[model samples]
Target: MKLASLKTVSNAHNDSIWAVTWAPATEARGALLVTGSLDESVKLWRGDELEQDGVHTGHSLGVIAVAAHPSGNIAASTSLDSFVRIFDVNSNATLAVLETAPSEAWLMQFDLKGSTLAVAGGGSASVKLWNTSAWRLDASLSVLKSDASVKGSEKTAGKFVLAVAWSVDGKLLACSTMDGTVGVFDVSRGKLLHLLEGHNMPVRSLVFSPVDPRVLFTASDDKHVRMYDAKNNSLICAMSGHGSWVLSVDASPEGSALATGSSDRTVRLWDLSMRASVQTVTDHTDQVWGVAFRPPGGEGVRAGRLATISDDKSINLYDYS
Candidate 1:
């Protein structure tokens, strides 16, 4: 797989662009790219031309994460102040505003069926799950510390959940902490399955293989991306090359490739089958905070597309194949 720079939107936002996701296509419109920034706004861009569609600006602080519903009609954005705003993708109508007390939000994601929205609870040491139907607090999967003492101080102990992901089957939920521990949970039972360990620094991003529910990938401040077997809690492999922290990692829908953004100011595409980076694009002047692959399936769409947002206040679109 290779990435050909299709377009670059310089100064896409006033401040750092931290979050990005693809709103799936509908009969009325094609797939749109949604991005959130430290400028306290979420903006939409349509087509390969990267035309600006609209912007929503009510967030009090920097927007840390953005997620799109599977149906492409709804999307959500979270801010540093612990607020989650869900809105209509096309109309930008506010659907719901979710607030999590005792926890701040970091990353947001929708499950495969789009029935639930998962938020990375920054200081709560948990994953806050919200029901999409009534926009209610569904459940909180708290990560238990290894220490048996001081259990009451779980909220203050500083796990600082930084990233979250769900298996394609929707049966498994994985979350990573600032200390690099990854917790896997059983969604139906609401139970913690196991903890995977390797890195000593913060784990900023992770994604489950779209084709294989058991395989999981993670990027960390340790400057390495590790793959694991979620069910068995076994480390499968580790790939390293970035000169700085690896901030984000995403798997292609075909499951044959992975894309990662880093503090090294570059985006690297990995060949999963070979466990190595095959292509590197060094176009961003600042750290690349987010990298996302457009989910396959939209009218007249065939070629794969990948996007990267950066601290340089810019967004880059690439044609992937």
Candidate 2:
């Protein structure tokens, strides 16, 4: 299937859509999309019409990360303010407020079991874990100083934690940092497991393959996307083509393809088996910050769907299949 932009919602957001995730469908509500923006607001959108369901504002700075709980009833968002806000998806009501000052925050994610939330602690050199039941710090997984760890980037100023992903089983957590180093950790043990190496620029986005626990993919400012064998901590392959920085990357729910948005004003589709981009959508006039494949679950929206948000102040939807 080829991509023909189905709809473009111009000025849907005031700034870049930094993160996006699909809320699974419920008996009462169709699947919704939760997006965070540099505008310092987290917005919920009705997936079908792209209508504003609601907006949650309180973050002092840009909202960098957002994830929907597996239960679909709740979601969590983290901001540059070092705060994580857990809110009810349906009502857009605040549920829990989590914060850590000494350990700053970046991207965040919830485990598949919906029992824990993971926050990438920027510069704190740790990934902080929170218990969803009590909304308290459960553990802190420290990054190691091993000789084998990926060397810090010479050009980058920070080892600031930037992105995070949890294994499908919720046992393994991988966090990427500003220096382009990815640290894999064993959540239950609170230990640093291994570091995935390759990119030499900030790794802005990372995701574990939905169907494989040992596979992880990362998007970096180095203009490349890399796949990893998480269990062995080895770089499997790298896909490079974006002319500018790659801001975000996501895997399709079926786990057969992936999507990426870049500062070059384009969104790309890659077939996992071929490990090559099959199509490029260049409708945006400015940087495209986030791209996501809608999670599969809704009864009616039974198609492969992709959404991209741009610094052009637009949100574009495409049919993936």
Q: Compare the candidates by lDDT and give the number of the best one.
A: 1
TM-score of each: 0.97, 0.93
Cα-lDDT of candidate 1: 0.92
Misplaced by over 4 Å in model 2 are: 146-158
Error of model 2, residue 182, in angstroms: 1.0
Error of 2 at 213 (Å): 1.0
Q: Clashes in candidate 1: how many?
A: 0
Residue-level lDDT tens digits of model 2 in 1-321: 456677788887788777788878888877787888889998888865689898988888888788888888898888878789889988878999887784478778888888888888877777888899999998877775545456655223465787789988887899998778898988777778877888899998999999999999999999999999997889889998899999999998889888999999999988999999999889998988788887787667687778888778778888878
lDDT of each: 0.92, 0.84
Model 2's TM-score against the true structure: 0.93
Q: Which candidate achieves the best TM-score against the true structure?
A: 1
**lDDT for 205 (candidate 2):** 90
The residue pairs found clashing in candidate 1 are: none
CA error at residue 225 for candidate 1, angstroms: 0.2
